[model samples]
Target chain A: MNRRRHTIPTLALKELRDGIRNRWIAATIILLGTLALVLSFLGSAPSGELKVAALEVSVVSLTSLSMYLIPLIALMLAFDALVGEFENGTMLLLLTYPVRRWQIIAGKFVGHSTIMLLAILIGYGTTMAVLIFTNDGDTSGWQAYLAMMASSLLLGCAFLTVGYLISSLVRERSVATGLAVATWLLLVVFYDLGLLSALMLDEGKYISEGLFTTLMLANPADAYRLFNFTGITEVANLVGASEIKVGLAAPLLSMLLWIVVPFLLAVIRFQKREV
Target chain B: MNSTPTIELKAVSKRYDKLTVVDGIDLQINKGESFVLVGHNGAGKTTIMKLMLGLTQASSGQVLVMGENPANKSFSARRGMLGYLPESVSFYHHMTGLELLNYYASLKGVAKTEVSSCLEQVNLSASAGKRVNTYSKGMRQRLGLAQAILGKPELLFLDEPTTGLDPSLRRDFYQIISDLRAAGATVVISSHSLSEIETQADRIALIRSGKLVACGSLDALSEQAGLPVHTRLAVATGHTGRVAAQLEPHFEIQKITDHSVDLVCPVNKKISLLRQVADLGEVVLDINMNAPRLNEIYLHFMNGEKA
Candidate 1:
């Protein structure tokens, strides 16, 4: 009983230490920070023209950027979480330890999420800090900006969970890599592209407003988008998003579901998986 | 009453789809016994180990390790009491040996102090601070042995542990196994090359094509195999002719010299033949008995099955 408590933390800490050693944390921070700073510097001009807070305009740009970057990084970080262990032959020894399969999933999630959290903090935090230092005393957009940053993390975790599911479903790392890239193309790129095509082709004929609303939330990246964009009307208008049919809780709840559902499925798949 | 076995597989069979990997294996590994499982590649030796570890579930029948069903989803406290070294052991390459052992120690609920002792036992203490990526194959194997011996586990599984080890390293590996056995740890080893470990096994199970074809101690299997045991006798100069005359009637003479005679007899016939030879004690200068090897017994079994 006493040993079980430390199992997840032990595993999580190992992954955290691995990330630090591999310089993944540093790479993620640098990538996110450089991109956020560049967007913040160039994004304020639209804020002046559109009469929106500079931070809010930057949130719009970051949310769009996150749709591509967060999921890609999340998938890359964890696509082989289980498969790599199997490939390396470490999974056999890991299973011999006194740990349930779900704990493995939970521990990996916590560790990977920590890495993503750090990246978001140092990266997005830099932009928020610069905006505050240079701006008038209006702190109105900071709330949406924080929510966007948090939602970006939620988005990353959702993809991380999806990557775990991919890892659980396959035997080879090459297959996992291919499936992960396909997942990014589908969820981050093709999902929105398909939606746009559906909207263009449907033109309000076959797809209902509520159905369109649900479809947007069905994709986790868009759900994150709706969270950051819909809360601020000025940012929503700047991004040209149509009026959201659902309340704020809808996107948040959907994002939570995105994290929970795939994670549970991964655990189930992993439990039945033979080492 | 028989004590509960450390591991028991009752009619256990594992199949992946239409292919059966382990077929109705019924085995009992007693507490504190050193057991070896030997078979050719893809002969289901590793599958049996995996079944015992509950790394993969058996398709049919029951497996009990340390008196608990290892496949049970409820947390297994016994897992902390069990250790395994896979065929090709791998560690987190980024971690130092000390860190990796400490990680396992924490999971096994062992004191952190045991980590160093385990490293020392495997002769890895000098490089404990070095990352696994820098360690040589032999060093990594020793490190794996170090990990498997952690917590002084009640049960330890080593799969093909000496595949790439040097002879001296192999001797070191078995020395640790003997130490663990002295400390009452039940060790199960799966290997294709059982000849090297033949002397170390308390009992060995020979698996062929997913079925346990034969299992017993070397002598017992040799008996069951009906392989001949060789006996050599040095006779007094003039007694060799008398011995050959009497023993040739009951034994097959392998060789004959002026003062020495070598006789080969069936396992069952050996005792009686030896008794007859002992009657001529004064005439016989020395008597030597050589039992058949595990590999020969294996070949006999394989040939018999083939026939």
Candidate 2:
């Protein structure tokens, strides 16, 4: 067997193990799991021909909920990365070792990301399991449901990168926590409201389809929403969901771009950080 | 006096805006020599250590450990040579002592097979699996010490190594330091406790307000202070006045009391002076001879010289 022996994976495993042992992580996982279950059961809709089944609807809604929740968890995990060491005074001891600073950052990122991924898998996986068992392997929603699950993992990666960026930039854990919460509110909730208000005030003519596409491309949350509702919504399907006026790529590609840019920027900043 | 200088600072100076933390200190710590740096608060002792370890950048001059800059990103050779104990040894509270050691051991590239024995060395074998948060202050210090010696690092930097330790533990700590020195590990210890470090350090350096005020062996520094080694004489009768008058012209008499007299003179002249003082009068009580300690030398430079 060819094991790559990646530093990130090793660190991620270590972090996951540590998290599993911690009561905070266990409690958070339970809370998120309960939230996933409630969101799934409460949000499901009746099925129709060519429409996603109740289980798939539940899975999709749960995936959207995860888009917001996973990032918060990631930030909570990483905000104190450097600052915690400074408070605890362990950074000096670590810095004296032969390991490079980038490795430390990368390793920690991977570890926390793995934990987030595990949480998502466990939480959403349980929701899916309940849906499948309740419906008795109803086959209608499985494909689309799997796609949503995959997208949620990608979204978790995106949020994990953001958390690392916050950790790297801030010197105090308390400040980082506040900033992370504020950023979550802004990017996940208020950002969409702001975009919607802007579009409404500008009217349909001035905003244009290209401007709407470009705006959606700028924010990960919007891009994720666009991907989640791509051809599913009656209004979007009627407005010609297949057209790509903002270049040749679809909204999914725009979402992928959102994932790549911030991730790369975080890695760049992490590589240059001095312990 | 060893073959190699484990830590070499060439014209190194570290400044924070208008204030200099470490000022142009050119120092070399020889291999296998327990070098002690003694100074008070803001004396730049910690700054020098930070500069050597590349924790802080020097404003000017060069720092080389084993002929390489520790600041360079790719300078693994220099970094691998060092095992450092920070002033306040804080660790990951969530991790057990063994886990923390294993984590550090892996970072230092120490093979897993040797970790158990390394744990044993610090007397942490019994509680190695316990979380560090539960460990006492002395236990944490010992854990920190264990990590420092994990790979048998060729160079070690210990800042206040015995701060929270008990007396017996402190003795054990020095014994380990001495063994490290004997086994060819150069150790640099920075501390405010001159009494404890007096016997441990083969060479001592004094820093005052970011500048190297004095650097040498105890005997050499004592000579540099130029403060006379004190000799106290106690007389039975009223010869205190007469003896003071008799010896006043010949030597610089520091103090003359009713029953006793104290004088500062050369270490070489102590025997002859004692003989002369005894001959002049009936020496009823006792006489004590003492050399100037490092604390007095440090105070002399701190108060008398500009940093």
Candidate 3:
């Protein structure tokens, strides 16, 4: 029993080691940091006389960047996590151990969540550090910035779970990759596009305010957006949704549900998967 | 051998959707016994191993390891009692050999300190710090064996453990298996090409198309196939005719030369016939007996099944 409990940390540590050895963590940090720095510099160019604080503008731009990038990178990290093991013939050996399949899922999810979290910290943290040092704005803008970083990790967890589901459901690595990409397109890109088209078509006629909020929160990416952008005056004004009424509960809970439902399904599917 | 079986499959079968990969298989491997499962690729050897290891659930019937249903969630292979080496053994390419083995050792609840010793046992100590991607195929296989033997598992499952190994390394691999067997671990090995294992396996199960065609010790299996034990007799300068005359009544001549004759006799009768040839005294100067090979026995049964 003690050994069984120890299995997840053992496995998670190995996965983290793999990430470090392959330079995955380093590359992701550099990628995020560089992009965040670039967005901070150029994001204020189109303020159009609003003269909002630079850090607030950075939050708006970074949120948009993370909405597309975090989920995509999370999917990229996870598309091959299980299927690749099967292809490599390592899953068979791994299953012969005393660990359960759900432990494997738990361990990998924890490892990937940590990786994404680190990327967010060092990547956005650099920008945050620069903003503080430059006295770009008072510490008031730090709240939304910190919230965006936290919610970005949550969004990453949601997609990571979805990626595990895709990996567990498919047999071929190529199929997993294709399915992961297709899911990202459906959620991150097309969901918003489809929602925009509907709102334009409705023009405040058919889609009610509550329905619009539900629609936005249903997709994890939009949930992340609402969680980051809601209740922030500068960003809310920028996206032109000042009248939006939402507590911290709905989108946050929806984001967590996005993480959990697919995670549970992935565990179920992986439990029955033959190595 | 211990009376209790380390692994028992009673009419166990596994089906993947529309395909049946493992037919009803009933087998009992006694504790400390070394059993080999030999067949062509896709003939269900690996599937049977998977079933025993609880990597796959049997679609029908029962599979018990150490008297516990292996597929049950409560069954813990990590109590430091079970080990497995999969075919074409692969590792995280970015990890050093020591790192990979250490990870498995930790997963199997083995002491982390024993990792280097395990690598040394497989002659991988020198390369322990090198990444797996840089290791050769044989090196990877050695690393696999190293991890499989950690904790000195009581039951070890090896799927084609010796593939990609040279002749000397194959001999070393079997030596390690023999040592494990001597240590009272029930070992199950699966291989498609099995000639080198003739003397290593205490018993061999011949599988064909998800079915056990024949199983037993090599001598028993070949006898069941009705393969003959071949003997060659070389005579003195002028005794060939006399030796052939005496041996002709007892056996079929596979070949007859001026000075020697090859006789094909039933395995059970080979010893007696050789005694009889000795009884003939100086007529035969030399005698050579050939045991039927595993491949021959395998072909005989595979063809019989096809027919």
Candidate 4:
């Protein structure tokens, strides 16, 4: 039992080490940091009191950047987990250990999650700290700042789970890479478009409220939007009427479901695979 | 012969669809035994190793390492009982050799401090700090051996262990296998080099077309194959035709180009045959009794159903 407990953490540490050394990881971090910096300069609101506060200006700017950048970083870090190992022939070595397959998957998930969380924490963390320092401690934007971090983590966990699922489903790394990128495009971009078309075709009567509510809960990105837009004024209204009722309960449950379902499927497939 | 079987396969078989890769076969390898399995390509040698390590499941029958099924989720009890060196040994390219060994050792429940000594045993101590991707094939094969020997497993399964090794290094690897046998670890390996393995393996198991065609000690296999142990004789004069006719019924004369004639005689008939051949001609040429090489025995069985 002690050996089993150690498997997750040990494998997790290995994942962390591998992630830190990966050039893809370094490149992702730098690209996301640059995007954050660029968005800070472009996306800030001009009419608000935050105009004078460069830090609040940056935080507000990062709100849009974090949504896209965090998921992108998370996807890049995790999409190749099992498929990459399969290609490298190390998965066979890993399976020879006494650990269970689910434990291995969980360990990898945890490890990738840690790297994602740390990246978001550092990149957004630097921007937030800069905001607070430059804004003279106006701290009204602090709650939104922390909420954005939490949303980033929630979104990251969702994508990492998606990545593991892709790795499990596709044996070839090239195929896995293609499918993973397509999944990202669908979920982050096309999913909302599909939902919008469905809402329009429904004429806002039947599917608009209930289906939109379910869709918001179904797509993890929408769940992140729920958390970020719940307390805010303008963005909350623009999301749709059903999103107004999305509270801590629905989004949290949805995020938890996102983490559990795909990960559980990955573990199940990993257990049966010949490694 | 040792009594306890460190590794056992009971009517084990693996199949993919209609094709059987490893047919129903039973192999019992005792503790401290150095057993080598030899075969051609697609002869199910590596498949057996993978089944032994629980990296793959047998379509039927049981494979046990140290009396427990390797695929059991509660396999921690037997975790360090066996070490496996896969065919193409590739590790985390980012980790140094020491780190890779340390990681594997930690999983096998070895003390972290003893990792250095494990590396030393395989002569990889100096290269321990280098990344795995930087290591040559011979170096990687050494590292693979190092990892396999780390926890002092009761059984070791090596697949084509000397693939990238030179002749001297292959001798070194055999020496290491001998050392493992002396230390009471059962070593099982599969390779194509039968001549070298003839000295290394306590017993050889021959697999052809996924079936166990032959298996036994070298002498035992020779006896089973009914291969006449031959003696090469080089006589002093033109007695070639006379000696060839004299030994025709009892022995096979392979060549008589010069004064030398090579005749193969049954082990039991060699002494009398040598004397008769000597009396027929001047005994200037010496006699050398040749035990049938494993390669010959391998071809004999591989060609037909003799043994």
The local lDDT score (0 to 100) that residue A30 gets in candidate 4 is 72
lDDT of 3 by residue, B178-292 (tens): 8888898989999866678777788999999899999999999988998998888887867777787888887887777878888899988977897889888986889888889
Model 4: residues with Cα > 4 Å off, grouped in runs:
A1-5, A23-26, A37-43, A47-63, A231-243, B1-4, B232-263, B267-287
TM-score of each: 0.95, 0.86, 0.90, 0.88
Colliding pairs, model 1: none
Model 3: lDDT of residue A172? 97
> What tens digits encode model 2's per-residue C-alpha lDDT throughout A43-90?
654434435476656655665686687667766787777667666787
Q: Can you list each candidate's DockQ?
A: 0.65, 0.34, 0.48, 0.35
Poorest lDDT segment (10 consecutive residues) of candidate 4 chain A: A233-242
Each candidate's interface RMSD:
1.8, 4.3, 2.5, 2.6
* Cα lDDT listed for each candidate: 0.89, 0.75, 0.87, 0.78
Q: Candidate 1 on A1-275: residue-level lDDT in tens?
A: 34433888988998899899999999999999999989887888767776778888889889989889999999998999999999998888888998888988899999999999999999999878888888766666888889889999999999999999999999999999999999999988999889989999988898988898899989898888888778567677777764764657888888999999999999999998887
Q: What docking grade does candidate 2 earn?
A: acceptable
CAPRI level of candidate 3: acceptable
Give the number of the best model, judged by TM-score. 1
| DockQ category of candidate 4 | acceptable
Model 2 residue runs over 4 Å out of place are: A1-10, A48-51, A231-275, B1-4, B231-289
lDDT of 2 by residue, B241-298 (tens): 8777777776678898888888887755666777777778555377777888877877
The local lDDT score (0 to 100) that residue B231 gets in candidate 4 is: 71
Worst 10 residues of 2 chain B by lDDT: B72-81
lDDT tens digits by residue: candidate 4, A173-233? 9998888789888887898889888888888778857667788779887777666666454
Q: Comparing candidate 1 with candidate 4, which one achieves the higher TM-score?
A: 1
